[model samples]
Target chain A: MATEITVGVGLIAIGASLAVGLTAVGTGMAEQAIGAAAVGAMAEKEELFGKGLIMTVIPESLVIFGLVVAILILNLVG
Target chain B: MLRPKQMLKLTIFGPKSYMKQVIEELYDMNAVHIEDYTKKSDDDVFDIGNPLSDNEKHSDTLVKIRSLISNLDIERKNILPRETSFETIEENVTKLHSKVSEVMAKKEYFTRIKEIYTKKEIKKALSSLRLRFDDEFDYTSAVYFIGFVNAEIAKLKEDVEKASKKNMTFDSHYNGVKAIAVFTDHKSKDDVEKVLEDYDFSPIDNPVVKEHFRDLTSAPGQRFVKLDHEVKAVSDKLKRVNDELSELKGENMIFLLSSEKKLTMEVEKGEAPLKFATTKNTFLLRGWVPRNKSKMLKKKVEDVSNSKVKMKFEVPGKHEEVPIEFDHPKMVEPFEAFMELYTLPSYKEIDPTFFMFLTFPIFFGFMLGDVGYGLVTLGLFLFLKMKMPGMKNFLNAFIIASISTIIFGMVFGEYFGFEFFPPAYGEHLVDSLPEHLINALHMHPMESHGALVYPFPHLFSRSHQISDLLSISVLFGIVHILIGLVVGFINIFENHGIVHALEEKGGWIMIMPLIVWLLLEPLGVITGHVYDMLASILPPLPVLGIMFAVGAILTIIGEGVVGVIEVMFLALMSNILSYARLMAVGLASLSLAAVVNDLSGQMIQSMGIIGIIPAAIIMILGHGINIALGILSPFLHSLRLHYVEFFGKFYGGGGKKYKSFGYSPK
Candidate 1:
């Protein structure tokens, strides 16, 4: 029983890291395409910078949510 | 704020001769937005003809002035025009053009003569050498070569002795470094040349010289001196011409600017007939004038054209497109920049700039809730505003948004993540903080007796209570989406009628709150406090099911049955959930600030007093990055929520903008 509990805690730690880290990768992947296109649009018309910036950052929330889940897993459990 | 200002369409008719005067007056007044007469046919009494010819003298003078202006490289300034008459300015410009051209022509002629004369003289001097290429020399027996070599005659003499087996005689001319002329018997010339090649010899072209040297004492080497002197003389003359042009430019700067402005206006005036409907004796002009400015416009037309102009006004049809003109208060006007980033609001639709103005700052401030960062941002805003006034609207949004950041930062009690707070709150971090930083950022972190006093209240902290923050974020999502739906409802109720609003926007408005309340059921059970609250006020799950059923029915009626599945289930649900991003972004900023403080605090403890240096450096660098991301991230997200999530509710903009047919000196 003690070993089972130890393994469970270990898995949870890995899960917390994986959760935030994987989501960061996902957000970065999403942003790569968006950022390139945004830069292209900005190059054509300088006024598009605001819209480009907004679109470029929209996927960042994915990682933020991931951080929340990671924080919960890291702190909330015994 | 919601609707565009009222507009009145006007028709102004005048005699063909008065057309130019009428256009000039309207342009000066700068009130009327012209509707070009291209839509009308020639068969109609008001058919517009081709524009009258531009003033020939005006165009020619403008061309000459422009050339002079560029040639002089005048620095353009918004200086007041000098009170010089058109005739006087024109005469001066003509004279300046002629003077510059004369100097330029002299320089050009000198350049041409220098190139040809130098070449001829070099050959003449070379022919005077009389070693070869003279009438006494026989071409069949020997060959003559003249060119520069890598080695001078002294160096070449040693190389020639070593490399050549041919019996060739050599003579060294006076310090001949560049000029090396070789003569050898035709039978052994190739062998002698092979040895010269070892010395890196390169032959200069011996063009056929028809004339001999003019002076017996002149050295062929001295030809470079003469050519260089000629080049310098021409360049000096060119510089003098440039100086004269610059002086003219300095004295006549304002006159040139004024002439350009006057000519451009005349051109626009002359072209007015192409836009208006004209006959042999009369011309008709049609345009939209703002209702408020119409009275002034009418009076100006009468005064400027000697009452030869006749004007009329009429209301446009309901379905017809009309140009939009916004009349926002000066303070709220900057939010128009946000509106323009997406699209302009449709003619009949309400402008959402005011709604965006209020919400955007709130979202931005909440996300970047820190005092030092906010003040820094506000400082940056002021700097940009001072530097680039033309970017007023864009910079003003940042200025206004920073105000919210300061307020939220104070509420959060976070000045660079509590570096300013007293060490008593967190005992582990106490040793890391420098003495001054504990009271820096204008807040002292000191304990009062046994009791603890916070610098400012934290209404809702981004750092603590992660789960509760998520819950609050969900709640915020519900409220925000509900507000969007309500705006949609109001928009539809006015533009589209109540029944459609009730079934479409109204259904979601009713359904969203109930769903949020129901979803919280599990959390309430675990928390106990919310369970009791839910048990006391809210009904069973069946009630939620019934409410959704009714809402789905209304959605079906309004947007057809497919909309319930696609829009209500997929789109609406996702949109409400998306508002959780607000909380997520705020937490990200909080986490970054806390990490910086924590790292710096810990590292400081390790180094003690000396640690303060690296710690301060780390804090500055970390916080600098944090501040840039803080400003741009929150600003962009706030704008995204408005453009993608909020404005998606009721607005679609394709309205033509109102542009007054007027001229100002650029």
Candidate 2:
């Protein structure tokens, strides 16, 4: 019973970590392209900074969603 | 407050002779946004009018004055603005231009002389060769080379002697790089050059001949000494010229600045007719005037033109794209910078500045909630406001945000990540309150007394009440999104009628109640028993599930299948979940502050008196970094929430901002 409980807890931790870690990686990948394009646009016209910042951070919601999923997973199972 | 100022389409036409007077009147009024007249290929009745007479004269004078201003570095703040007549400006400008230009020409001559003498390498080479300024080389029978060489002087001389087989004189010296001068007869020059080329010789110009100073009958050392004396004289003259220029600037600073202002206006007024459509005998101008100022504009134009002009005003048509001018109160004016940074609200849509003024700071404050950080930022912004008055509007917004941060800080019972009241004080305060009041406020007398304390007399401690904070963040998100949806509904309804509004925005509105219900149920604010009792009359899962279903169906019907996925999950669900950043960011800030405090405390405790240095350094550096991040992160997150989440729902921002004629931004 003890071993089973330990395994269950360990798996839950790994699952939670993966949920946040994979989404963060995905967010970074998405942001890389967006940040480059945003910088290019800003270089041409500096007034595009606000719009560029907005565009670059739009993909950030994916990581936040992943964080929410991780939080829910820990709360519900652990 | 909600919509842009109303504008009327105004057209004025008059005899061509009155064009100048009318334009002058309009410039003084500063109320018109003129529509530039374009001539269509097929239109032969009207063409763009020519600029007023003497336009070139005004333009020339303006350019001269602007150049003078730039050359003198005359800033507006250095000179007081006052009226100056056109005659005075014309006379003074020409006189100043000649005076300044003459001095400038003398300065340029001396600067060139100084440059020639400062070539130290050429001076060194000439001195080493013991060459005289007046030395004559017979071009017919002799040749000389003065340059740097990569090979040893002995080897180069030997190799050249062997190759040329003629008498030659070689002078060489090393100052970082080899400087060598070779003098040979013209017949042997080719053979000597061949050997020098193998040695990688790089030539230097003979400065005496290049500078046309070869007439001086003196050795290189004496010539350099004379040149140095001349350079000193030139430097003194340059200094005197600079002083004279500054003196001239001081005397005419006010005259020049005021003249610039007047001439600029003159030029603008003179060229104004070019924007008008004209026939052989008359000119026509079309523009927008604020509705309330139309009567005044009419009076001014008629008075100035002596009633020679005809004026007409008409309400804008429904399809017309009118320019937008914000009409916000002073308190809400600062937030307009955000709108300007993004895009202006379309003429027909509601302006979001007032709403942003209310909500943006709250979001910012919620994320950076700590009494110490708030007070620090508030003081910082206030200091900045005084130092950089030009950024008043931007600083004012942050000032308000910091105030909100203070309020949230009080609610969270945090002061620099420490509990506002220590445990002993908190216990005493909680005891003094009435028992029922304590119960009502849900006060707990004793708890952790470290950096994060959850005690009575204050609201939930941010660090301890994690779940509660998350729930409240989601609640704020729901309320914020509901407001966005309502605004969207109104916008669509105004433009496309209630049918489309109901189909598009109403679908989202219907789903919000279920979202709220789902959130409340988990927090134990509502239970299944209430819905279970209504289950007999309503359907299973009751009103909430039914509402969700209908909302889903309506969304699908309104936006098609793809939009259903977009509205339900992407827009509605993910956007709300994104607000979780509020809790996450604040928690991160608090945790960092706590870590800094704890680390410093441990350092001081374990290491005794000598540890104070490192501990203080750690505390200062750590809190400094945290505060810097605190300011930037919360501000960006709050802006993102409004721009991406809230504005995405309703705002269709691409309206033309109103720019009036003769209105210069200061």
The candidate that achieves the highest lDDT relative to the unseen native structure: 2
* Model 2 misplaced regions, further than 4 Å: A1-7, B42-44, B78-81, B105-237, B420-457, B517-540, B567-570
lDDT string, candidate 1, B523-608, tens digits: 23112333344456656667877776777778778888676665445566556556666777877788888798879988889889
- Location of the lowest summed lDDT over 10 successive residues in candidate 2 chain B: B525-534
Model 2, B35-100: lDDT tens digits are 999988765689898888878888988899988888877876534335666777788899899888
Off by over 4 Å in 1: A1-6, A9-19, A60-78, B39-60, B63-73, B81-83, B97-246, B302-310, B424-457, B522-544, B664-666
The best candidate by TM-score is 2
Minimal lDDT window, size 10, model 1 chain B:
B207-216
Error of 2 at B393 (Å): 1.7
Tell me chain A's TM-score in each of the predictions.
0.82, 0.89
Name the lDDT value of residue A75 in candidate 1.
55
Candidate 2's fnat? 0.43
For all candidates, state DockQ relative to the true structure: 0.38, 0.38
Clashing pairs in 2: none
